[model samples]
Target: MVFDRLIHPFCICSFSLTVSRTKSESGVPEVPVPADDTPEVLNKALSGLSSRWKNWWVRGILTPAMISFFFIIIYLGPMVLMMIVLCIQIKCFHEIITIGYSVYHSYHLPWFRTLSWYFLLCVNYFFYGETVTDYFFTLVQREEPLRILSKYHRFISFALYLTGFCMFVLSLVKKHYRLQFYMFGWTHVTLLIVVTQSHLIIHNLFEGMIWFIVPISCVICNDIMAYMFGFFFGRTPLIKLSPKKTWEGFIGGFFATIVFGILLSYVMSGYRFFVCPVEFNNDSNSFTVDCKPSELFQLQDYGLPPVLQSITGWTIVKLYPFQIHSIALSAFASIMGPFGGFFASGFKRAFKIKDFANTIPGHGGIMDRFDCQYLMATFVNVYIASFIRGPNPSKVIQQLLALRPDQQLHIFNSLKAHLTEKGLLPLLEEAA
Candidate 1:
């Protein structure tokens, strides 16, 4: 009798949970399709083709168009790229939150949507504020209001977040407490995934447009090559999460992206505008992308190993050092980047959805397209920190400028003493 009582309630709970999942709507929710959308036009144009061929044509047509738009944004400058990143971040957050709402039927919950958006705003303010303080320290110090905010940025961000937390607590009802907390957690995870990665992307951009452009272009290249190879020669499945992915496509994409990255890096390394870090010109009160090229961007002769030198009949080859780094970036994009898409695929499977949204014709949602890009962004940021970046002179000078006069003099004296000990001070005096 005791065991029966325990199992009876457990069975009821399990049955109820299963029922809820069954009732959850799936497959792109009930978004009303507009008659004049690009997908519709393409569908009509290729009505005579089979569905497989139709998808191929649609994706091929839209893919290059999207690449052209991306390059155009790059030409417009870094500011435009940052803005586009923000817009895409917002859209991705919305798509994920919408999925949570539909799956949980949480739309009726008070302050759910409002709190989600509020948290997004709070997070953005914190990140962008930090970016301003880091990259535009002069501007921040010049403006009193900005200086105050920069000083108290973290405290202000915490207070804003605490306010939202209290609102969520107050909004919770007797029976809806669990559901509200679930949504709260959902919102934070989405923020971590979308907002944080996008912030790192902007950081990479400030490092140099090459850092930003090369990794992203590699991911785009791998994605395209993978699909083309799969469509023509896919036989063995790559992963259960995405049935369309195949071993053949994966290998083909890897080699293609590496070559593409190397060529692209070599070409861009020659241009100062592409290779220089983005910086604010205090005199002109504008952004500048002009600097003497670093050794990484300069062409250097690399001798081949004895075995390879004999086989190829070449002693040494000239290449930008950045091109070697591109091999690492491209390798990651081709190998590990697909895991991000696989994760998204699993998330969709859990919700029984075909796509996140119908926002992009032939592609799924903006999130669908960016799933791998976010992962790639994170890797490139880490790679730069670990292997590529050195202590930034501009940032060091900015920090020194922020110090008190006495502290600044102390640093100057300390630096002179250290250089004097190294026998470098007399050379500096001679140069002066």
Candidate 2:
């Protein structure tokens, strides 16, 4: 009887505890619950939290750190900027060549690697030779060695390239001819994509740091704004090539990039260091940025549109001419620049890879960072050639000064006759 009484009380206590746990303070039935926390469940929750924290750190900290470092390099001037660009070109070429090699891993073609590098050297020789001849003509004239090289640069470049071609042909095995040809084509295409665009980037830099700075800044702004907007509000996907891209991000990035371009132009336009072209000053025996800036860097009054006038009660707005041009540049950056990245995305997807390389922590490789930049460079070069460039009197004068005394006098007499014929110059005083 005593044992039965204890059992009855224990059962009643257990029943009461279960009922109390199930009901809320107001006596409503609560949702069902698991009575025990399993180790697996706890571990999974912890793992998810850890992964989220890692992503957050990479996006917030590492990305900004890299951007800051790049800005510092930009501020160091064009020489440093050019070096950085060259380094990027090499790294991008490396990544692309590595991909091609991986795709044809079975091939053991002879001298393929050496020939690829030789082609790179030949292309650089051609492009940089052109740049030096064009921009530093006086310097080349002063140095006999460089003068000789400049005279035969094209022939030398062609000969070097031909040698590489011959090497490639000789190195091919009968069984691997098809693969060897495939790699040959691949190498040339990669050179066209990487080296040609890089040459244009150097051209843009020579135009002024503004051209280089503004366009690149716009792309960076677009990329950042797009990512931010997408993370918070993206729904509709923008393209199949890049699954994470969204329409919301695209629109957001576009608007942000326009504003960014305008602001960047305004700021850079005020600095002569950024507005003036890089030139070698014979007088100073060093590079100089002292020339009068182009009209694009000058301020112009633009009539405000009706919509903005209604809000601000202003009819005219004064801004740098390049600020106006920035609208087109930014539009292209937001709309078309992303396509460069999309193409890269497609390339990586085909290879079943996540990134070209993990050199930048969260940012992938140098090529990944510069994929959009190369496209922007090409556009900037084309835009300058079409709209901004004109006959440069300074370049003309520099070239004239580089000629021998006899040639100079001959040119002077020819110019005098032409000007006289055009009625711009008075004929010499009659008969001393």
Candidate 3:
């Protein structure tokens, strides 16, 4: 009887321990399991499946809707496009600064919010001033009001920035100084990331809509192609930061983007609307897209490979020079662009957040969509500076016009002497 009692209690204890472990492991409340025929159990299962299906349907509809809206905005023109970018910049700044505030919530720092916004305004003024002064020189020269602003643009920008700096310094509290400085650094870094990239994006847009559109489209194409390939064939993970990305997706997207870039270059190159730089015409009193397009937009014959020529009975293929440049753009979009997304993923993971914001139904946020685009923008700007952009004679003349009469005369004399040394002054005089 003693041994039987001992065995029974031991068995009971072991069973109780197993039940407790199961409950803990599953992380479910200790509720009684329903019978196999219970209506409640069947209803719960059906509800779960229905919820999942609804989510899938919502995502399907939202993706295309967002894409259509984007295309509509792009079709509107540069001014509309710029306004959208500015809105995005503000929203992204809010999201990032909000995160910083949340992380440093315990400090309860004063004036942090105001200071952040003030800095944003300062940076925008500085960058936009440079843009207007550079691209819209003629307008600045024509308008007396803008002439004053244009002359002291940098000084005005610096003074405004200094005012923000003084405000920040004056607002620092004794105990919260560390927190305030941390937030200050946060604001500046966010500005560098968001504002600087956006400035580059505007620069690309000013170069030509093609520079802006094609690079951005290549990024979008790569992203979609990558996702489709990953969803269908992904097995091996491409990176630990993003668990869903795969090597198959990356490689497939690369090839697809190259083809897409080539085709897009062909179409955009034919149109003066896409290839022409945005410029304000003094004669027309409005912006004009009419211009003789660069040679890159013009067609050139490229010799085909022997095997391809043999198969197609053609030795040469005609294509825009810009198409060759597109390969580089597409390649960067394929290779380095995804790293921008990866960096964002890692950033979100660091903060234990899914996305920067929930602005879009399925796409997380504007920042999420634009992470790669920002990187692509920087690349395009750098590419244009290194390979495409040249000194603008018109801008030079405008700068000379803005000078004092004596200064203008001195420049004119210097130019005439230089032309005479090159034996071009006689030709210029004869033509005149």
List lDDT for all candidates, in order: 0.88, 0.82, 0.83
Question: Against the true structure, candidate 3 has what lDDT?
Answer: 0.83
Residues 1-432 of candidate 1: C-alpha lDDT, one tens digit per residue: 645643686554433433243342321224222233455678789999998998899888989899999999999988889899999999999999988877656237898889999999999999998888888887888889998998899999999999999999899876566667878999999999999999999999998999999999999999999998999999999999999999999999999999999999999999998999888888999989999999999999999999999899999999999999999999999999999999999988876777888787778889999999999999999999899888867568778987999999999999999999999999999999
Native-referenced Cα lDDT, model 1: 0.88
Which should have the higher lDDT, number 1 or number 2?
1
Please identify model 2 stretches exceeding 4 Å from their true place.
1-53, 392-411, 417-432
How far residue 350's Cα lies from its native spot in candidate 3, in Å, is 0.9
Give the alpha carbon lDDT tens digit for every residue of 220-287 in model 2: 99999999888788999999999889999999999999998988889989889998998988888988
How far residue 232's Cα lies from its native spot in candidate 3, in Å, is 0.2
| Candidate numbers, best TM-score first, in rank order | 1, 3, 2
TM-scores for every predicted model:
0.92, 0.83, 0.85
Candidate topping TM-score: 1
